[model samples]
Target chain A: MAQPDMTRIEAAGGRPEAIRLETLRFAWPGRTSFRLEVPEFRVGRGEKVFLLGESGTGKSTLLSLICGINAPDRGSVMVDGTALADLSAPARDRFRAERIGVIFQMFNLLPYASPLENILLPLSFAPDRRRRVTDPRAEALRLTGALGLQDDLVTGARAAELSIGQQQRVAAARALIGAPALIVADEPTSALDTARQGAFLDLLMTQAEAQGATLLMVSHDARLSGRFDRVLDLSEIAMTTRGAG
Target chain B: MLLPALAWQSLLSRRITVGLTIFAISLSVALFLGVEKVRTGAKASFADTISDTDLIVGARSGGVQLLLYSVFRVGNATNNLTWESYQDIAARPEVEWIVPISLGDSHRGFRVMGTSAEFFDRYKYRGGRGLEMAEGARFDDLFDAVVGADVAAELGYRTDQQIVVAHGLASFTEHDDKPFRVSGVLARTGTPVDRTVFVSLEAIEAIHVDWKNGARIPGQQVGADAVRQMELTPGAVTAAMIGTTSRLQIFGLQRWINDYPEEPLLAILPGVTLQELWDLIGVAETALVGVSAMVVATALLGMAAMIFSGLAERRREMAILRAVGARPWTILALLSLEALLMAALGVLLGMALLYGGLFAFRGWIDDSFGIYLRITAPSLRELWVMGLVLVAALVVSLAPAWRAYRMSLSDGMTVRV
Candidate 1:
């Protein structure tokens, strides 16, 4: 089922917003005191935005809410053009699997899987994503190679056997393999040294830009903020994004 | 399908503990199935002891007592029927044939039965199979003896070996002076007949001619040669097994024997009496099954403990799966699939143990005890029990599956670990 490139470009001709959140209010189910309230947020297509928030400042929570991992108490999270809150839980999982690529902090790779297997795991859960690739293993190999992880290392080594920086690159290759519409990096460079973090960020940003996917990088480090198009501090959002930072 | 493969890989990574859990399950399964096999086997062997004999007639007593003494050689007979009564029963117009069995003496704990040549010609067991000699000719002399297969094996007796017949049941009271030569060794029938020693009725009469009131006369010692000069007619017999001329006449003949007037007599149908005996002993059999079932439960609990302890470590793995778009139910399915694989492997290993154990110990069991357990395929009841065991293990394993489901929901792509 090959759709013409004309139709894909037409479908991509949406309101030009990759992610839009309006009046988002979220509180963990059991804890009513801590909540995240965002009045307005938008990330343009292909734009790289640095979200600056320290640990516990709802940085991970915001990423989870945006990706449909956790639902907001009262808000609308529109990814691409669909509202995630309107879909069923299972449908939301499928939506996330199909449209969003998440790269977690270090040690997030499946420990028992090889680098290539880790990269292909999202496709295992989401067949639509798998259908997007002509050959998933080859795509994984290309991503790993472009991310500066050696071909031999990615092919032969398991996640546990790889160094922390290598695992981080493998995680990024995994996120970029299926070329989802949005790439969310949740403090993914926290474990890498300052020298390697910059290189890793360069590779990640280059891959996201090449795929025409919007990038949302969350971190407390302000030094890396200058490399992005815009920066949003969590503290200035509202009283809702409280206690975490 | 990919989730199951992933589950397999996770289990393989923890191969040592998983292997041990499988081993525990297999042992319990083996013991559980083993007990059932022996229970059914023993029942079959017991029911098959004297199949063709329509009615077993003995001195008046409880039907179980008569069965135990006459067929199984278990307890002493309460009384003996006079030889005249046996003759009258054998000569009846409705009788097809009769095998008069005299059980009292023993040869090294093996029951010594004084039966006639008709025993070889007419007696049948294990579905109408007659005795076939394994080594030598049948007993034809005055004192020639036919030893059973088990007796020959355990005592190492062969043709022409002189075996002394003990007067009483105990081995200490030996009839040392008058010994009988083994004429033949009977083939194994895997029945109580395999443990009996057979001789002519005349031989039994000659051996105890001088004994009165269960003790020997101090001055009476008859030589083997002199026994030929004396008349050798058995005064009484333990019991008589009768086959009616027509199958329809069996009930009538049983009623006649039960009402005999010369001496009090009890007559029983072999199949019915065997079932009664089984019912009497089935209580212990049930306890055996219950104990083994507990053993299986303990093994499953051990598996649950192993899975529960590993859950804390696997929370991170669950979060990773959820992050990659695996639903909570997918995590649940993965855990359940792991348990099913372990149960299937355990059942296969238990079947192997059952058949292997039966094959290895068939002979020793037959020789030491007369219970013959065959290496046949599992019965439907046995298969059902195995199915129940699998279901139970799966049910026990769901605890971890539920925990994983809840953890995946709460963790939400952010593993605390």
Candidate 2:
């Protein structure tokens, strides 16, 4: 396979469309039976999209493709109008660190790190993201404050010490830090009660909107779709996707 | 830099395993480096046991055996040289000085050496370092005696104290009527010299006048003062240390003595003989090093096992790091860095233990074993071994680090846990 040319796909300062997929096809190797094909997909910059998917619907695979962690077998993933397939693996990693922030279901924060340290992790990897912030620690503090976590909670306490709800907010704060171009949340609110789930979604949506970030959240719950700008079920996007090939 | 911080924090979370691993590595390192120290020390101490003598002339035997008895005070000589042969060699113009030593007597397990006054003035050990008295002067009277540092210390004898010379090699049979006064005590030399009691050749002759063939003649009790006036010069000597006027004549003199017609003799160069003996013992030293190397390998393997076992529990942790934008290689580097830190710290800990041990036991080792070991810096070879240990630790860690890399790539940000 021909490798991507990272230097040619470098984008400058201005913002572009958040996500664009063209005839995307992907599958895990060794078990070639299962596959996913997205003929055409686009999410506008600053769009809040809810991707509804059941457990086996391949939502995580699609997210991995979008973030360039898994390269498409026969298509292109374009974020900010830059083709992820056109960048090398290392470049793709740098691009993801600079542009995409992801929140997993639970335990998203590093168990050994304090809440603030967890939130500041992305900046340590992406110098460009760090350059955009005047003071990273202050930015982390602001994000945690906006996420409704107290100062004392984020300062000295490790992520493992936080309660389930507190850890969810800390994950949100981490994903929302450095004002990345996109935020991908994979069942981030599943561990929360219904009332806290609504509150957590509200905080996440508000933080993403404030940074002008494109929020692509995947969840099985349909009740939270009313608050998103757009909603699409994973079954509509992934075709014949099996369990990790 | 940030990777190290993360690695350190990660290790701190599981400090117990890491601590145990480091401790195990340190003990192995200490054993490895400690054996090296003792090896070098043994060679150096052995080499320094005798110096500046052109030849050690003794009964015909192996060079090592000759050196063992003449220099180390170990074992007995096969035969003694007649007094006339010693005088014949001493009269040569090439012979600058000679110290004839006769051994067979003992005082409380310390060997007794009978020698002339020339011994104090000309004999040398450890590169021409002459004997220095720690207490009184050299023996002047017929019944006066000089003690080595260990002899004086072990027997608690000071100048002016009287001590009996045993009739034989062991200290059980004493010559009570012929007790001698301790006139001097030699300073510690960290050699066999420190375990011998020295007296004039006249004293050796006088104490044995009534004895024949290892037994006391029943009717021949000679008074101490009368025997002192009689001819007390020794008839034969065990060995003679010859210092020639020119280094060029040493081989000729050695050849001449070895072929002497009256008796069979062996003359050996101390340096050459010492080297031969060290080569014989070098095999054992190499084995010690090989065993310690295996111990170090085992300790590093323990560290690798610990890292491998942690991978299962850390799968989710790996996923979290990836979510925070750590590359797969970063995960690899983090794991390897932890192992490197442990090995480096182990080397430091091992060195500390080695030097600390040397310092603590310096006196006891010198006094008991007569092996003087100084706390010196690590030699280039020792440093290379330490470096090899770290490299081995890193190599051992590679398997686990590669596993982490694979886990991060396969599991992505959604570890099943």
Candidate 3:
């Protein structure tokens, strides 16, 4: 594992925090009974944090807000010192593509695309991210090799043909491409066994650290929290009472 | 550009569904084009049947009826025009040439036309193209006959072959006693003339001399040789094709023939009567076009239904795309482009099928229906139809595209499915 380079973080921004939220409020439209409120949340720059929550605890909603997929009702979502509310919908999508990389729990790759194609999908959406890599295909090949994906599997096999563990590694490579400032993983290892989960987390964290990026992974399993720098419970962060699951 | 590539790959992933949908659309397209081709081909061939003739003179009756029986040989004439009337019209200074035609006889399901020997020189078809013999010379002997291309080919009749003409339009009453020798076979004309057998007017009068009232007398029979020495000038004829010396004299000559005091004779401009006949059949053509258009609509709607139903299972795919920084509009464009590609392929395949079918069936259609389907490049109207189908496909695709857009927006990186 490569060590984090402090010079890159200082060049990106002098600020100590990677993500900050203040007085956030959100609710689903036409569903008046459920609401989520958070007073404050922060993740430091180059930090590896674990967010623990069961299903139906607004774990996905918080990730959506941080990625700018959904706008908060009242407060601001600021990632890498840029306020998400200040941007238009398309700009927010571009901002997410350039600054944030996300890995879903399962089915993180397009089934029909080859593994190399899935790894380079983000560059297709973000010109800024594409400009960061001088040779996109070579960069994708390097990332796939670092993630233990064989050249034949990356080139010849479709994403659907790979095992679940291989798919998660490809998804991790996709998330870490172009050295995005933030990495958000939503139970990325939930389908893996305990041994593979720890091994996958080690690779993901090492890749994030090498890029000087912050990792925020949300999972229901508490046993995986020991490896992270910090852990936060969703029930403690969200100040509102649970209305409906 | 990347989105269209993605769309293509996505469509290729589900080959069976996409292939079935394209097959349905292509079949409908082929049917639509086929109907349009037949409609235009029928009209063109009908208009090309006869040309350069000023007027068709027959007994006083409907103009369409006169044109049908005299030119198409489709039905019997209600009455006959006297030979005196024909001679009177032919003597007028405006008449350049006149060919007398006598119908009401058959030879093996082919109409037998009794005409003057000069008919070969005066009659014209397909834009003033003169008749040319394929085998031998024109009829000269009293019992000599000539056959059209189709008649000769279909019945295997060669020059000098003897054939018995039957009285009336069917084979029930045969004039077997007076068999005529085939003198010539005309070249193919791609008209109703190709289906007729021709003989000199004297032969027709000789065959009917002993017959009375559509039947033969009990003991009266005329030998083929004995009748050759008698006076064979026909007293009456079914109709005549007349050409004028000047184009300006056609209407005047037609009016004079219609108002002649000798008999109730009708004269009609060939072009005008042909238009009237076509207009009468235009209603059926319009109905056929309408039915084919509906079939196209149905096929397009089926494609819409197929894509719309597949969107449900694709919710997770949409979420994955959204998570990778694809906007809702990107998903919308991707689905719409997939449908457009399918429609374009279907159209191309349909054109190939249409031309292939036409090339395979051209001869059969000409022989069976007398409609010469020219295998030419697609007309502007046909290209416009394909363009309209693509537009329709784009419009129909919006339904599924809009649905996927909404799904990607709402699902937003975390679809439950």
Candidate 4:
């Protein structure tokens, strides 16, 4: 239902400045009490900024809103200096597909699919990114290699066969493979052992640095806070955008 | 990813659910295909009535009824055509051929017919060719007989086997003295002849010489040989097959026979009579469609419950999807695709099972019920129904899919931990 004249993804392409978010307040209209009011959040150009909050403080909600999943009820969330709330649902999806890569704690990989297939699943929906890549499979392998996954693990290893740490690394490679400007990770280290968690974090940060994409890693683990350039606990930033809890 | 691929994996992972669903859908497909098969069978039997000859002449009855009793051996004719009338009718200038058939007799639970060599050479049921001799040739001497394909198979009769005829149509022998040699066996034609035993008309007259009112006379005996030598004079024939000079004269021929003054007669075109008979068969078709539709609908209902029941567990999965930049719409598509895929697999599985069952039991069904369900590849109608099942499954999935979308978006990145 769209004319070719309206395609915007071609103009922005991939760059560190592509995705941006400002003071944003999101409300769930029907469920009277459930609402997320994030007043300020932004991941600067190629900045691997870690955001922290406890389990129930809407840390995941804040990341999703910043990533343009749920449009803010008030204020604004901009990616590449364009207000995300203003775009249509399909446009938002296309935008996310092209310029924003999201990673979840569980990795969100389809169980029966091999790691390579899981890595390529996101590209299926993002036609623009698919076209942009000279060869997406090669790009996926490169990302997987940079994330310290062995070449053998990329082939026949299914998501269920991989350990939690390995799955997290797969999730990271999938996110960074498309060369999207921003990658959002949600409690990705929580499922791993303390030893694997540090190694996993190191691999993820290294991959983000290599891709030169902004990273907004959400976690409640305060011990890991010192590694990032700036660790902003979500609550401290929310006061200005949403006056109270 | 293509929907089927995802669906296939989902189904493979959930073996029990998918198996149950497939079982449910296959039964529905069988019911649907079964109705179509029986309808085709009835039409085949009806068409066998007048395929070769141009016309059928018999005592006045519904054109279809006359065709059924005379050609297909379905029903009995209330009025009999006198032998004199048959002689005059067969003598008509336009009548190129005639095979007078005298019914009203039975042999070991099969219909008994009495006729001459012309009955074997000229009388055609499905096409112009006469019945072939699967074993021995047609009867040459009187009292020599050829049994139908089914009768021979059922009775285990081979060439040179001798069988006795019982008076009337009873299953047991009443006056079984007259024995006839089985000279030939006919091919299976899926018609009444499959259950008939053929003998010369003289044999029929000879066998009954001692019988009166379907019983033996007080003190009379007529040997099979002596009975055949007597002057042949057939009193009545149940029906007669007539061949016209041209197809264009069919209407005129029908009118002429129906208006005959000596004996009331009815003539019917085989194709048209078959179409009318379908009205009677249509009832079963309607019932089958209804039952199969309910089955499919109920299976979809089961699919819906399977999904909605797992909604609580899937909340986390949907949240994960949302985290991976899957829009609410994507979540809906994913869940709905799950249901659509299951229903589709069920339908396909159902069809395959139906084909298998038919392939396995076709012989038994044909033997027992006189019907054959072909395991032939599904036709366009079956495909259309399968397609409908997919669409229905998709629509059926919409409810839980919408709910999943809302649940995911509301919970967002933070599901209730």
- Give Cα distance to truth, residue B401, candidate 4, Å: 3.4
| Candidate 2 docking classification | medium
Tens-digit lDDT track for model 4 on B1-417? Answer: 544565566567677866777677667756666666665655564555446677777888788788777766766889988888888887787788888877778877788888777877676655454567788989887778999898999899998998888777764545467788999998876667788999888778778778787667877887666776787677888888777888787788878888989878777776677678777767876776687678778878887888888788667666655655567887788788878767766777777777777778888777676565556677888788888888888998899988887787678766664
How many Å off is the CA of B344 in candidate 4?
A: 5.6
Model 2, A78-185: lDDT tens digits are 887678877777778888888899998887777887888888888888888888999888888898898998999999898899999999898888888888889999
Pairs in clash, predicted candidate 3: none
Output the worst ten-in-a-row residue range by lDDT, candidate 3 chain B.
B408-417
Better TM-score candidate (3, 4): 3
Candidate models: Cα lDDT each: 0.86, 0.86, 0.89, 0.74
In the range A1-245, model 1's lDDT, one tens digit per residue, is 12223433355473546787889998887754678888878888888999888787788888888888889888778777677777788888888888889888877788887888889998877787899899998899999999997888988877889999999999998888788889999998889999998999999999999998899999999888877998988776634534543
Q: Write the per-residue lDDT of candidate 3 for residues B220-324, one digit (tens) a residue.
A: 888988998889889999999999999999999999999999899999998899999999989999999999999999989999999998998889888877887
- For model 4, report DockQ: 0.38
TM-score of chain B of 1: 0.92
RMSD of 2: 3.7
Off-target runs (Cα >4 Å) in candidate 4 are: A1-23, A32-43, A124-135, A239-245, B1-31, B72-75, B127-129, B156-162, B171-178, B210-229, B299-317, B335-378
TM-score of 3: 0.91
Query: In candidate 4, what are the lDDT values of residues A1-245, reduced to their tens digit?
Result: 12222233344344324445455666655654556766555566788788888876777667677666677777877765566767787777667767778788884676767788778777776776677678878888888887888988887777878987788888888887767778888888898889888888888888788777888888999888767988988778764233343
Give all TM-scores, in the order shown: 0.91, 0.90, 0.91, 0.85
TM-score ranking, best first: 3, 1, 2, 4
> lDDT per residue, candidate 3, A59-171, as tens digits?
89899989988898999778877778878898888888888899999888889888888989998988888899999888887888888888889889989999999999999
Ranking of models by DockQ: 3, 1, 2, 4
Clashing pairs for model 2 are none
